[model samples]
Target: METIIVENIYKYYPAATKKERNKALNGISFTVKNGEIFGLIGPDGAGKTSLFHILTTLLLADGGRATVDGFDVVKDYKQIRKRVGYMPGRFSLYQDLTVEENLQFFATAFETTVEKNLDLIHEIYIQLEPFKKRRAGKLSGGMKQKLALCCALIHKPSVLFLDEPTTGVDPVSRKEFWQMLKSLQLQGITTIVSTPYMDEANLCDRIGLLQNGSLLGIDTPENLTRNFGKPLFALKAEQMYPLLLHMRAYDQTATCYGFGDYHHITFIDPHIQQADIRSYLQGVGFTEPVEIRQIAPGIEDCFMDLLNH
Candidate 1:
């Protein structure tokens, strides 16, 4: 079953003058399947949050239509709110309230109680139990994250919308959070998570790569990377900074960017060999420790490829 459906949606923010309005969403269309974890992947200002607000019925689209669990987003907002959970990009909880207080407040607002939904949030709730009495404002970033998620799920929502849920969270907390989403999927909850981190895109069943309020592509991470249709390589050398500059300056270098410990590159001339890149680096006075070998394209690589051309 399709839990969410969006078609030709468009949204714009009016500027000082009518001629220069900021277009936040342009011809956006996609669907989320029941029990599927779909990811909207892109950098900031890619329309992820805008699209989220429209689907959740907090904002109206200038054009087109959407439905949540088969209800019209515009006319059935009240019903949608009752059945869906939303965690905005920013922490909007009552800072002065204790963690437990915040959870209870949200449950009450949903016409439910935390105790009634404990089974749905047991794993995350247990982690926040120790900090139950702590003021939400005083909790660490990770703790605040957990408390917010617990409150969002207090009503046992059928669909959850998480906007950058892992932002500003520790590595361990981020990993735990994704695992929690996976568990929710097992219970037949549909999840739509948006993140700017390319690495996180791989965790979703499928991802939509958005840029400048437009979707570049949508597919499974493995399939997208495999279909990039290019020979990619990772190059590392003694003077990493200088190596980067020289490699980018190389005539045949199509794309070059620093990625973790190595500089990843793609070739403009498909016929170019690995040995040719090695010799070029050597001639440019690079140290002997220089290494260049073929590597598989990652999501980030594919994103850059899409953005570049």
Candidate 2:
């Protein structure tokens, strides 16, 4: 069942000059299935947050339509709000309130009680129990994240929207947060999450790559990488930046971008081999050893490829 449907959504913001409007979302469209974890993967200002606001009914789109849990985002916003739980990118909980108080506050606002939906947030709330008395402002980043999530789920919402829930969180906390999302799936809650981290894309059932207010592509992580239709190679040298510049200037180079410890390059000619690149680099000023090897494309590689095209 489709829990969410967004069709040709468009949004615009007034530009600084006031003579032009900046398009925040450009005919974006996608769907989310019941009990599915859908990820909006993109960098900052890529329309992820704007699209989230539209779906959550916090902001209206300039054009097009969207429905959450079969309720129209515009006309039926009240119904949608009741059925969905939203955690904005930033921590919006009361800083002066303790963890317990925040949770109770959200529950009461939803016309529900923490005890009434204890089972819904029990797994997550347990982690925050020790800090129940701690003021939200005094808690750690991870603890604050947990508290926010607990409050969002305290009302037993059928659909959850999390906007960059782990942006400033620690690595350990990020891993734990994804695990908690998986747990929510087992309870039959549909989740829509947005994140700038490419690594987290693999954790979702499927992802939509958005850039410059446009959707680059949408598919499973494995399929996105597998469909990258070019031979890719990772190259490393003693001088990384110089190697990158040299590689980009190479005649056979199709796409060359710096990855973590190495630069990933694709060739215009599929027949080109690693030895050929190594030989070319050696013939140039790169007298030192150059490590070049064929490597599998990852989600970031796929996203970059889409952006380039």
Candidate 3:
């Protein structure tokens, strides 16, 4: 069963202040399978947050329709809200409230008690028990994040919406958060999480890549990577920026972009031989041309390829 079915969803914002309001989400559509963790992966300003808002019923779409657990977002919003838990990108918990108080407050809103929902949040709440009496604002970033997740799960919702939950947290905390979400999947809760991290796309059962309010592709991480028809390589030199520009200007160099420690390069003419790249770099006066080899296309590589297409 699909926990969520989004069909041609679109939303546009009006101009505010001097800036023109952007098309936050174009006619984007995707399905999140029941009991699975689905990722909406993209960079900042890619409309991941806007889509989350619409699906969670926090905002209505200007076009299309979406349903959460068989309930239409607009027509059955109350029912969907009761069955879905949302954790926004920012930490919006009550700063003055103790960890336990914050948890209780949210649970009460859904007409439940922390004690009654103990089993539902136990996997995450247990991590927060030691500092249950501590103020939410005073807790460490990791701890505060866990508490916020527990509160979202307090009502034992059928589906969970996490909008960039690990954006600013430490790496260890990010790993822990994903583990927690995976654990909840065993309890039959569907999770729809949006992330700016390309690396995290592989963690989900399926991922939808978005850019500039449009969906570029959606597939299981394995399948998406497998379908990348172009061969990729990481090439770098002392003068990186100029080298990239030079490569892009070449007819054989199909695509080039910064990839963390190195720049990723893809060739359009597959038979164009590596010697051609060497000659091109040397011809451009590139000093100490670093290693270049055929590499597997990562999510980031595929994303760049999509943008180029």
lDDT of all the models against the reference?
Answer: 0.91, 0.93, 0.88
Model 2 whole-model lDDT (C-alpha atoms): 0.93
Better of 2 and 3 by TM-score: 2
Candidate 3 structure lDDT: 0.88
Q: Which candidate do you rate higher for lDDT, 2 or 3? A: 2
Q: What is the full ranking by lDDT, best candidate first?
A: 2, 1, 3
What is the Å distance of residue 278 in model 3 from its true position?
1.8
TM-score of each: 0.96, 0.97, 0.93
* Rank by TM-score (best first): 2, 1, 3
**lDDT per residue (tens digit) for residues 1-309 in model 1:** 899999999999876787788888889999988889999998888999999999999999999999999999999999999999999999999999999899999999999988999999999888889889989999999888888888888998889999999987777888988998888889888999999888899999989999988999889899999989989989887788999999999999999999999999988887788889888878988756778788899999999999997
* Candidate 1 residue spans exceeding 4 A from truth: 16-19
The candidate that achieves the highest TM-score relative to the unseen native structure: 2
Please report, as a residue range, the 10-residue window in candidate 3 with the lowest summed lDDT.
284-293
lDDT by residue for model 3 (104-212), tens: 8999999999999899888788788999899999999899889888988999999999999999777788888889988899899899999988888989999999999
Best lDDT among the predictions, by candidate number: 2
